[model samples]
Target: MAKNILIVCTSWDKLGDTKEPTGCWAEEVIAPYYIWKKHGYNVTIASVKGGEVPMDEASLNPPYLTKEVEDFLLDDEAMKGLMDSVPLSDVKGDDYDAVFLPGGHGTCWDFPDNAELIALLSHFVDYNKVISAVCHGPMGLVNVKGTDGQPLVAGKKVTCFSDAEEVAVAKENVVPFMLETRLKELGALYECGPEKWAPFALRDCNLVTGQNPASSARVADLVVDALTWK
Candidate 1:
């Protein structure tokens, strides 16, 4: 049977108190979606509130926008699927082989404290199912606890959008909390690429994580490989 994959994205469209627009990073979700599709996985899109999920306008501009993102924009079917993502409340971990979270600054505002999302992640962990996230997506895992009542990331090798990268983007102060710091505080053995914006990902048992938007495709590949190997 084809493995079913759930892709969760942030529904928040605002960037902190700056009132600037932000949503799911286009490349972060698009690159991985196509990669998994190419590997013959069934992909489904979901979000906190669902319906008309927004793409960060910044990620759609030059330098950040890549062929994969551009292709997703031009693909009507894919575009529709993204715009019509299901509500997170309607999703179940048992129905999917894996769940992936794609990030944007918006995720920092919503992903961290969502009780339902935390429960879903815990479900995947309990079952030893693959759980993956990139950039600020890992914010969702910060509050997830394992069956033993410990932070799921406690002592687990993981990575996410780093403090230096956030500082470079001038949003270090804008986001609700520093993702890198919070992950470390949660006892994640955090790691990052040598330089900011470089592609880096880590896999620890059933959990896979990427450091930034540049690592999205590689993270998806890692998830597919892990599922296949199992």
Candidate 2:
């Protein structure tokens, strides 16, 4: 049977109080969505809210745009799926083989404190299922508890949008908190590649994470490998 992968995205569309538009990073979700499809896995897109999930404007143009992202935007089926993402409340973690979260600055606003998201991730951890995220996406994992009643990321090797990268993008003060620092505060053994904006992914057991938009594909590939081992 083909594995079912649940992809969670952010519904928050505005930057913190600035009213500037920000949502799911196009490449973050597009890259992984295609990778999963290439491996013949079923993908379900979901968000904090049930309706259309927004994309960060920054991710749709110039330096952030990639061939894969461009193709995804033009594909009717893919666009339809994203536009009609199922609400997180409507989906159960047990229905999927694994779960992946794609990051954007928007995630920093919604993913960290969402009870449904935390519960969904908890189910995966409790069941020993693969859970993966990239960049700010790991914000979704911040509140997830392990079987031991501790943060799922605690004592686990993990990586996410780093503080330096946040500064590089000049979002250090705009985001709610520094993701790498927050992960570290949660007892995660966090680390990232030496160079900024380079593709970097890490897997500690069933938990997989990537460092930035560029790392999404590797994170997706690692998720596939994790599922295979199970």
Candidate 3:
């Protein structure tokens, strides 16, 4: 049977108090979505509040947009899925084999400190299900605790959008917190690729993480491998 996978995107569109527009990174979600679909997994899109999930406009511009992202934009069926995402509160861990979070600065505002999301992540961890995140998506994992009551990311090898990458993009001060710093503070043995914006992904057991949008497809491939091997 094909496994069901949940792809959670950020619902928030405003970038902090700056009122700037931002949402899920297009490639981060599109790359993984296509990869999982190509591998015969049933993928579902969801967001914190459900309904239309915005894409970070910056990610759609030249230099950031990719063929996969452009393809996603032109695919009506895929766009429909994103536009009609289910609410995160309606998502049940038991219904899916894996859950993925794709990042945007918007995620920094909504993914972290979400009690329900944290509990859902804990449930996935307890069941040994795959939990993957890329870029700012790892913010979702920050507050999740394991069965032993420790932060789920504590002592785990992981990676996300790095501080240097944020600085390079000039969003270091705009985002709510530096993702690399927050993950490290949570006790994650966080690692990154040799250079900023490089495609890098790491998997520790059932947990998979990617460093940036460039790493999204790699992260999804790793998730598929882990699910198949398990």
Candidate 4:
């Protein structure tokens, strides 16, 4: 039987400072989706608002876009599902083997504060399954509390969209709170490379995370490894 994996996509387009036309880095969602499918894992997507998921139009073109994305675009039914994804509340914690979050600026808005997301991830962590995310998706880690009532990320080493990357994507003056700084405040031991957009991933027991869109597939691979290793 295929192990079930849930990938969280962003429903919001604009972030705190970014504009609407700028949305999720399509690669973040597509890369992992492609990898997991090839690896024979059952993947489902849930969005914060549960409506149409916005795609970064810019990434839909050229070498920035991979062949897998082109195939997904051609599959009308699959594209429709991606456009109109299920809401988080409709997803049950026990239905999945692990949950993965792909990131973009939109995650800065819809992901960090969703109560349902907090509940889903909290439950996944509680059950000791793999709870993984990349880029801004790690913000989902912000609100989850362990049964002990401590921050789920407390004392865990993690990585997410780095401050430098956000600054590079949207000028330093525009982006909101630095992810590194905020995770640090929650007692998460944050570490990363000297440059932004580097492939950085961490696994704290079953919790896996990657630094940015570039690390999406790697994070998914790690998630699969964790599940099989179990």
In lDDT terms, how accurate is model 2?
Answer: 0.93
The true-versus-predicted C-alpha distance at residue 23 of model 2, in Å, is 0.5
lDDT of 4 by residue, 92-184 (tens): 989999998887766777777788898889888789889998887887788788768988888998998887777777634544567777888
Q: Per-residue lDDT tens digits of candidate 1, residues 33-79?
A: 99888888899999999898888998999989898888888999899
Cα-based lDDT for every prediction: 0.91, 0.93, 0.92, 0.81
Which ranges in model 2 have alpha carbons more than 4 Å from their true place? none
Clashes of 1: 0
Candidate 1: where are CA atoms >4 Å away?
none
Q: Candidate 2's residue-wise lDDT over 61-165, tens digit each?
A: 998889998899899999987899999999998799999999998998899889889888888988899999999999998888899989889999999999999
- Colliding pairs, model 1: none
Summed over model 2, clashes come to 0
By summed lDDT, the worst window of 10 consecutive residues in model 1 runs over: 11-20
Give the per-residue lDDT digits (tens) of candidate 3, residues 1-230.
99999998899899897778889899999999999999899999999999999888989999898998899989999998888999999999999999999999899999999987888888899899999999999999988987788888898999999999999989988888899999899899999999888899999989999999999999999999889988
Q: What is the lDDT of residue 60 in candidate 3?
A: 93
| Residue 17 displacement in candidate 3 (angstroms) | 1.6
Provide the global lDDT of candidate 3 against the true structure. Answer: 0.92
- State every prediction's TM-score relative to the real structure: 0.98, 0.98, 0.97, 0.91
Give the clash count for each candidate.
0, 0, 0, 0
